[model samples]
Target: MVVLSKQTTEQYAYIRHCNKTSAFSSTGIIPVVDLSKPEAKTLIVKACEEFGFFKVINHGVPMEAISKLESEAINFFSLPNNQKEKAGPPNPFGYGNKKIGENGDVGWVEYLLLKNNQDYNSMRLSVFGQTTDKFRNVLNDYICAVRKMGCEILELMAEGLNIEEKNVFSKLLMDKESDSLFRLNHYPPCPEMALDNKNGENLVGFGEHTDPQIISLLRSNNTSGLQICLKDRSWVSVPPDYNSFFINVGDSLQVMTNGRFRSVRHRVLANGFDSRLSMIYFGGPPLSEKIAPLPCLMKENEESLYKEFTWFEYKKSAYASRLADNRLGHFEIFSAS
Candidate 1:
């Protein structure tokens, strides 16, 4: 059995007082598409164009798989801090504890990150160990199921864009060599957040940021904390739906569509009493692939908004910067009329 770490109970809440003024609207809603229906394609396109995020119901992943993974994850996090430390000394993979600050800002979450490359044997051994063989097996099954679902979504997206090369993204992202990351994020309860609520401040579980990937699939426990920033800058709380998955558009898709579909900025709020856990699977291109605006998406005289950059180069730049930094600015192209 895994032991608990002394610091596990420590609360790491960080409130950004300035952002407390940002209007939070209870009426703003995310489009929910039933992927199993015939209108899924159209609904998906509209959601991407207007919200850059949406919820999916009837996603086809076995409910039993989700339950097993959630239970195993809780057990994994419960493991002693030292055992968890074996998963990392650095950031690319393994457990990450909350850092106090780089510039007086901090997140109130811990996560176990794993790469989904072809090197599963070694990676599994390193991350899960032999004792948790059953856990590792269930995780692999979930990955396969999720990746299959992701490919189907990509196909629908391509069809929605009316791209002639309908299989372009599927070939690039679903390939065996494509680089993907599976992160198990745990947000321990910060009971102190009750004080923030009383004082009109927000306790952040995760800071506001845009994902730098092609697509992200998130499955969260039934605890409300996730919020998305709308076009008008209002924050809308995403209610918990245990049966659905939250899908978000990423920076790559924004560039690919030539700004037609935006990458939404989102954050998670700290819960006052209940802890939260989420599994996020990021689908990205192979590092060698270059990303740029699709020629079909741009008008004849319209200039490319962003220059072409390889996934490897972009990932490196993103990792070097702060979570909230505008990593895409480095690739923006200027037009001279």
Candidate 2:
């Protein structure tokens, strides 16, 4: 069992735990889409509408790029605690541990958050030393491939919707000013959770929450910890496929579709022995972009279910709230009785 320091124990002690048996056993229920198929557009749309999440295969990203980045991330996380600390406390972009955000949400994870932009620089040269350039190159390669795949998926969604402008969704992400982000999370093995499972509770690696961006792409090692809440509110375990990427329709996408695509609420649990590593790319729009239901997607005289708000406003609101808070509730257009 991994022994936790007094501070570490206190940091995670107050976190909310869930029943380990709540996870659905059947993984076949999760949607799987092959991006190379001719029917991918329609399938992508269907998956988004139904699960707001799906596993994508043949997504055009090179396996070499994926493995290299994962290796680099592992090396960085393996560094001495002091060396890793030089990279951060994540002032919204660096390294973070246990604490999820400024809002007091804690988890059994440590992570590196980075802005996805042209000016992307290495996170503290001292952290990686001589391998900084290699790390940067690998990271850039991974981000480039993932961002392209994200744009492709969005265009496919527009095509499936039969929208006249196929680039309507993709263009936002392709924008140079897109407020995108990349994150690498490491959940170390916590055997203590198993010994303390008499109450049927498990440690939270990441709390349940919806992504706030337009879309998100996630790839993780072969670890069984991710769980997504279904429409009926039952949690289902997502079988890990390291070679494939999982796509999520984010809260922004949910609102832009006028609620057609519901954002999936998901969380992760700490494994008793195996560690879990995940990389996520959040594709966001430009800060100033006004988010609203596309006129083309709405029916005749259809009323918008949300008030128009800038991505900046929404993002600010999201960052200020707890992980499980309903970030969209403030932007909802309530009907007058």
Candidate 3:
């Protein structure tokens, strides 16, 4: 079994990144909403415009579903090497990896990836399907549940733009297309591989980075590694608020809106103890879709915020950035390069 060190329970509660001084001055609040209500329209719009990230208290996704996904993930990681290997290696698209973060240069974590809106019975079965039927079905169910809720949030973003809900969803999650899918991230504990305190003492949690999709749903176990950059150069910790879901806009939204939205950079620090497992649902359009900036906001000499590119092209570029550090994924293409 992959073991994680034990820290006090007090350590896990929402932690502010207190620098030599205090790290939290800006009060980062995620707007809470009940998507069923008419009032949620304005509330969600305002939330995205102001916070880029927010939490939904009354989203209809069942409490049981979220719990099950987390449990199964832990269970998968717990299995003997043979069962997981059935899924195959971490292919070009990031399916299965036993070495944790060691890609070309593995970090100290391991992960499994699946796309959103993907189909299993078709010509392209998930890389992990070779491993076991139960694994594939369980992951499939989790993706559907998260996407259902993700769609609701996308519709709200459309309302924020005052465009028909279908417009935004089309750009982010093309109808009838099972775009990229679920990524299971596991941060196994690392205690000895420490960096010099001078450069920047080794982080106790995940280094900073942001999701590449429209919305990322994260679940934190007893450990913590989430941090967010403020409008200022400083960064703050994203407290593990189990009662709500953390939603952040991705680079696509930042481009589509022509700068009205921000895809802030965030990351995770290595925890002194406790393995952190998180599942991120990437909402993407089909590789066939053109990823050019939306004309809706591209009018003025408004600084063509991003160059026109296809989803396939964009993801290739993102993978390169992920190589440097998770934070690189948060930067604009030019900056990442």
Best by lDDT: 2
lDDT of 2 by residue, 1-337 (tens): 2222323343563233455336445648777889899999999989999999999999999999999999988888887667777888788788888889898998988888988753455745347878888888899999999999999999999999999898998898899899999999998887666555555455788999999999999999998889898887777788889899999999999999999998999988875578899999999999999999988899998999999999999999999999999999999999898
Predicted candidate 3 versus true structure: per-residue lDDT over 1-337, tens digit per residue: 3633332322221223356312333564546677778877678767666666666767776767767767767776776555555554655434354333343433445666654533442212332355445555666776677777888878777776777535566345646663656677777765443322234433433344555555666555655666667566466566665556667777666666765777667766664446787777777776656654667656676555566666667766676664335422333455334
Q: Clashes in model 1: which pairs?
A: 3-80
Ten-residue stretch with the least lDDT total in model 3? 6-15
Model 1: per-residue Cα lDDT over 173-208, one tens digit each: 777668788988888776555544565555677888
How well does candidate 3 match the true structure in TM-score terms?
0.76
How close is each model in CA RMSD to the real structure? 3.3, 2.4, 6.1
Per-candidate TM-scores read: 0.89, 0.94, 0.76
Worst 10 residues of 1 by lDDT: 1-10
For model 1, what is the alpha-carbon lDDT of residue 95? 70
Candidates 1 and 2 compared: the better one by TM-score is 2
Best by TM-score: 2
Q: Which run of 10 residues does model 2 get worst, by summed lDDT?
A: 1-10
CA lDDT scores, all candidates in order: 0.78, 0.86, 0.59
